[model samples]
Target: MPITEFLTRNATYFKNDVALVEINPEIKNIPHVTWREYSLIEAARGGAFRKQLTWGEFEKQANRFANLLLTRGIKKGDKVAILLMNCLDWLPIYFGILKAGAVAVPLNFRYTAEEIKYCLEKSDSDILVFGPEFIGRVEEIRDRIPRLKDCFYVGDECPSFADSYDKLLNYCSSQAPSVYITDEDDGAIYFSSGTTGFPKAILHAHAALVHSAKVEQAHHHQKKDDVFLCIPPLYHTGAKMHWFGSLISGGKAVLLRGVSPEWIIRTVSEERCTIVWLLVPWAQDILDAIESGRVNIDGYELSQWRLMHIGAQPVPPTLIKRWKAVFPHHAYDTNYGLSESIGPGCVHLGMENINKVGAIGIPGYGWQVKIVDENRKEVTDGVGELAVKGPGVMKCYYKDAKSTDEVLDDEGWLYTGDMAERDEDGFIYLVDRKKDVIITGGENIYPVQIEDFLRSNGSIKDVAVIGLPDQRLGEIAAAIIEVKEGFSLSEEEVNNFCLDLPRYKRPRRVIFAKVPRNPTGKIEKPVLRKIYCGESVVAQQNEINIK
Candidate 1:
């Protein structure tokens, strides 16, 4: 069955149950505004978990939006671009597109006018829907998007050239139009991070999310009563498809407008969120808050918080240790996945396997995982390219057969560019990306282990380990670090801190600069490599200098 069927089925079984709880009622009054607020006094003010929409109401709104798309001449296979920040309206628009049998093309809200226009042209989007806050940006490109027939904006402050989202829905019928959608039908198209070059459009089938829910929930042991706190953007597969596990099991999904330490603590206490997902940086902030006594876990009745999962990057062992020190009773799971493979649906560390720290655990049920060499021969107990074959694999990269052929083999195996090694116990540990491996003086080094070591240094704010060109050796590891303000350190100090790291794995040099990170918090290594290699590129790292 497809993801739409899971949602439709749950809407029938758990009609009155709360599906999505939106805690942004205060923002309703703020027109044409989208900004993050952070203060020492307030800590985190949003995500109070007061406002909510039940499953029945959610389905009704999605059906209504589906009808609106059909009324606007959007037919099956038509792509509708969704360029908006994370909000209550995001999911409704996404599911609405799926329900209508139209394809959803999720764009990064951070894209500029030029980038947005390029994506629309590349995907051939028929319609564009964005937030009112981006009115100026859309206006700049509205005339340039030739195939863009309609534009709609959410919120009270609608742009002059676009129709109001809420007003448009009122004119359309509530009933969803009948469209024959099969399991193999393309349901959504997600853009890559475009770190290496232009972002590629990834096409996923209707069955993608359904399989993701079963694999994640089955491995994590999610229950109907579990309240999953979703902090990542819905445009990403991790937050969107991964949360389907909770919804399919009649669990409550709490959506935060943004991720902050205070909001995370407040939500866990207020909503009794049992399952939580976070990136390494966000998890580090929560641990810092707890250690500084700013957040008192005992003050809140958070005994219900059980499973906490981290993903989208390698888990620094130091972060896990600090996390365990704060919440000794909490179970932590680390996972590895990508957009092409239906998010973090492939490999997962089970809640019961918390003792197997630093491992991405074994492959989820119904999935076949193998490590293969350059000749495509399977290898045991050695690092090799990770390959997966399962229902969760995406259909293909949209309209790019040449690109799809490079990754997906003829026999249905998808070669994940990530390198991994299996333990004697059959557990999997992600070494690093095949592209990220650094060979210095005939010694090969994976950046993840060294990066994990560097994260333990107190002065290092953020770090990205990348391979740089060398005269003698083919490449050498260089650490680009972003330090906390008022703190100063030298290359010798940074090298000494990693003395415990194996001689071959230690960084050859350290450079002080703010490392750029993608939206999902993964360091943009390709951008960094280009910066050091002097390659002309489309995207550069966005760095924050020390005050």
Candidate 2:
């Protein structure tokens, strides 16, 4: 079950089929680059898209690159960092490192210089391959990271100090290296967004990638002919894993350059994408476009689009209803997963659960889920922590055995810091994040319920509920609202909309501001909490209820 086996298996079965259809700007954004036969083709557009590499071309280049690394004295298990965007060069470079038996550390493109330095140093990466966009940032911390020996760029113009990725790809090396990589060897190190604290690097073995093909594609019913439209960044586990599933399923993975309602609609129609994955916020935008009649999607040939699945955040029930209303024939699914467990493999709300709204469906085929109390005893029906154990479970947090031991218990169950309840028939309902729960007057309040209620209102663009400091109650629920542009909503009106909610669950205070969230769509509660509670430490209750 090694991860590379998925690719090799697909390559064996569908060597002649279209594996990848990249949108190249240089080729007028057509499906110009096809990954067939020997390797992937490169497509560049408008200076923005620099060079094209074919599968055969890319395979040879990657071998040369691998040989280059080998010549540089890089060895098996050595970490190589790829700090670039979602360009054609990025993924090939990653696979090349894997081919050389090196662990690929993909850093977030939006990370600051300090954050990038931390990841490179923490992973002990010896080589950094980045684009020119981050040259200044890299220069700031280049001297600090001692492990960094070589720097390479993807753009046509490489600085005097760094090597051009094009030169390395064009270098002639027909001989491929023979490297023995086991399933237990680390394949990737994905760092969490450092919004709250320093980011933790989550490690995944080569076997973890293979599990995606078995669990996700099998459960979701992905076929070889299915064309997938990916809007999220590949750095996140969900996007990368989804793309991997498409490849293993022998489907075409269509990646959008950027997410826009118009661009997404066009891509789906033009590519004839059968499966589409999106975040909740982006999903909301599509709904807004259809509702507002801003996008002319009616005349588009969208019949080919079959399933629209969203993850990375809890799907609001109201949003689901609106999505179904727009495209009655399209299947809508809400999956629940975390990076620690190899995204979206544990639980899924499949298309068959159309009538079962608001539930995260059942446990995945090979996974086991349990709701447990604080004492770690399994709870029959009530809400509690969600613990899952399965083949999809990650080995551990990279190098942080203590943190790994904290979350993953001796019994092999990894305690997801999420609160969920399961029905008698085994349907799981996500209540709210355990860390996001608000406690008021010693009662438990899940913010998801309140946020869903707020999102139901047409005027609300986005909503996040957090517990603000209260001297008497210790903590009280506060609703932060992001009013839709051109729509004015009063605090009284917003609060009145919550009259149907219980008294304790209602927000004690309402603020209108842009709420910050991580790229994965999880709310930064610690940041929100810091806004209410000043820099100084203050004593408060251990937990508060606001649901």
What is each predicted model's overall lDDT from 0 to 1?
0.78, 0.74
Q: What is candidate 2's local distance difference test score? A: 0.74
Worst 10 residues of 2 by lDDT: 37-46
Q: What is the TM-score (0 to 1) of candidate 1?
A: 0.77
User: Taking the tens digit of each residue's C-alpha lDDT, what string does model 2 give over 314-359?
Assistant: 5557668888889888988777777788878688877788777778
Cα displacement (Å) at residue 21, model 2? 3.2
Task: Tell me how candidate 1 scores on lDDT.
Answer: 0.78
Q: TM-score for each prediction? A: 0.77, 0.76
- The superposed Cα distance between candidate 1 and the true structure at residue 377, in angstroms, equals 1.5
Whose TM-score is greatest here? Answer: 1
How many collisions per candidate? 0, 23
Model 1: residue 199 alpha-carbon error in angstroms: 0.7
Residue 115, candidate 1: C-alpha displacement in angstroms: 1.9
Candidate 1 lDDT over residue span 287-394, tens digit each: 778878888777777789987888766665656777788788888887777888888858877778877888988887678899999888899968999999898887
